[model samples]
Target: MPKRILMDHDGAIDDLLSQLLVLTMPDAELIGVTVTPADCYIEPALESTYKLLQLMGKEEIPLGRGDYYGINAFPSEWRARPEIINALPMLINLPKSPDPYAYPSAPELIIDRLSAAKEKVTVLMTGPCSNLVLALEKAPELKGKIDEIVWMAGAFRTTGNVQTYQHDGSAEWNVFWDPVSSQKLVSYELPLTLIPLDVTNHVPVTKQFLSTLATQIDYKLSNLTGQLWALTLDTIPSYHYTYFMWDILATSYLAMPDYFTTELVKANVSTRPPNAGQTYLDDQGYVVKIATDVNTGYFYDYLLSQFKQ
Candidate 1:
């Protein structure tokens, strides 16, 4: 039987790409897609998610929205950079289906689906930990029902993408968005795997790949992804079309572990105010494996194959 996977996305370009990758994988069944409060506000995030699902032809699968924002933390501008700003308006403008249905909250949907699955379910979180944290809080018993959680958060030993923050290198966006929730969730004894920026920074979306995809898949989803890549290129002039494939790498690991290099170390989140969301390899606390590197060649090849011939 195929593995059941749930994705908690923030509706960023990378998140949409990751969802498409997981849906296309032969060995994984994308059970659901949840929109978390990360890249933008919850409403826009949900709108983008709905558009992505419709474009991918997965409209029947439920799309749920997460918390509005991280608890107590001020919102940041990094969420609305040109890459996201350009893509979100396009997604919002996409025509919606005539029949609309209401879905349960992200946390509730997670519990309901996980409870009914015949086998263990893997929750792939590519955004903030707010939904997971809320689910755990409401249903603490879900601790055993879940098989594992693959998260794309933290910076590990690498310099963070957000350099303006004065905190340690380990404090990245996802965690920093809601450190209190992340700190609470990481303390749980459930099996977890964290794919940090250290690994994802190596897997970039190059100009060649984007151009190839644009030429191959003429659908709205591919076009949006391609446009996002162009925006990234414009924002970071020196990098060309190269942008971090952070979330996609995490999803890829679920179907193809051979494409990544991982380390099984005890990892924990620091909850202290200034240092919150900082993850470390500690020997004494609850242990979880974290991916430190990825096979860039394999990623490029697999992503290239996803486009139409």
Candidate 2:
């Protein structure tokens, strides 16, 4: 049987790419998608997601809009990317207009879908844990229905990507957006596979790969995927070092676990001070399956193949 998967994202460029990745997984069925407002403004994110689904003929899949707000939000400039994605010709050309907010919000949607599911669902979260945490709170029994949570969060060994005010740059943006929520989710009993910056740092976006992808615009998927990355080119200096495959790496781990190395670790997220959202090994921390490394060459090959397919 194909694996039943549900996804939650914060609507970053990579997070949008990760959603496309989920659709291409041969052995998995994406049952639903929920958008957290952490890294994006809600409306444009939902509209862009809906447009993507429509373009791929996956519009029937349910979408949940997140109403929950995080403690520390992302920068306004970064949050504005979804609006640009929404305006893309590939996405905006779609027929149906998107309803930004679905009937059930994110937390409620999680409970509704999990309750109705026949098999255990793998929850792929590429953003903050706010919606999932709330869902677990409302229906603690939902934990039993979850096969595993493959999340793109935290940084155990390397420095984090967040360089904001009052932070020591020890936390990843997802966890740093809401450390308390992240900490709460870790305390749950559900199985979690954490793909942190420690491993994602190895999968930086390269000019060579972009050039190769640019030559394959005949495939609509590849073209759309390329356009998404193209938007980042001018703004991000030196993409090779500045940006890594963050959320997409986590999404890839679900479809191709053999391409990566993992280890069990007891870890906890700090919720206070300059070190807030920092993940550290603690005696009392929860045990999580942490991805330590990835086979970069094979990963790029697989990624290209998926886009072309």
Candidate 3:
């Protein structure tokens, strides 16, 4: 049987690419998708998500929105991306479907899906853990319904992507968005697989890779993938930040686990200031599987193969 998957994401470019990866992969069935306002304005995020589903012909999948605001919101400039992506000709030209407010909110949808599942569900989280944390808090027993959570969060071994006030630059943006939620999530007994910056930092989106993808845009999904990442090309020359395959890499592990390496680590999140959202190694912390390294050439090859017609 194919893996039953529920995806939760903040509407970043890579997050959308990650969703496309699951939608196209042969070994996975996307049961549902939930969008949070972490890296996007929820309106365009939902609009783009609905449009992407239509573009991929996966419109039957349920959609949910998270209204919860993070403690430290993402930058306004970065948050504007969903609207831009949503307006692209490929997405905006598609006919709009009826609103996909499947449940009252994200947490409720999460509960309803897990409770109704016939087998364990793999929760793919590419953003903050707010919705899942809320659902599990309300229905703690739902823990048994989850197989494992593959999340693109944290920066256990290297520096984080967030360079903001009150932070010591040790936390990834997803965790830094809502440290308390991260704290609550790690406390759960469910298996957590973290694709932290420790590994993703090594896989920045290079111009060479994008040029190669340009040659393989034979399918609609491949074209869409290229267009999405092409938006980040201007930032490539900047030394401060470059687009990394953060969420897509996490999503890739679900289909091609052999291209990556993992380690069991005892970890915990700090909810206090200065170190808030920071994930640290602690003897008393929960044991979680962390992706520590990846075979970049093979991983890129696999990613390119998925989009081939």
The digit string of per-residue lDDT tens for model 2 on 176-235 reads: 888998999888846999999999999878788899998889999889999998776654
* Model 2, residue pairs in steric clash: none
In model 1, pairs of residues that clash are none
TM-score of 2: 0.97
Residue 273's lDDT within candidate 3 is: 78
User: Which ranges in model 3 have alpha carbons more than 4 Å from their true place?
Assistant: 100-103, 235-237
Between prediction 1 and prediction 2, which has the larger lDDT? 2
The global C-alpha lDDT for each of the candidates, from Candidate 1 onward, is: 0.72, 0.88, 0.88
lDDT of 1: 0.72
True-structure lDDT of candidate 2 = 0.88
Q: Please give each candidate's TM-score.
A: 0.86, 0.97, 0.97
Q: Could you tell me the lDDT of residue 196 within candidate 3? A: 98
Q: Output the better candidate (1/3) by TM-score.
A: 3
Tens digit of per-residue lDDT, candidate 3, span 199-221: 99889888898889999887766
Provide the lDDT at 178 for model 3.
Answer: 91
Which residue runs of candidate 1 sit more than 4 Å off their true CA positions? 72-94, 97-103, 164-166, 215-224, 234-242
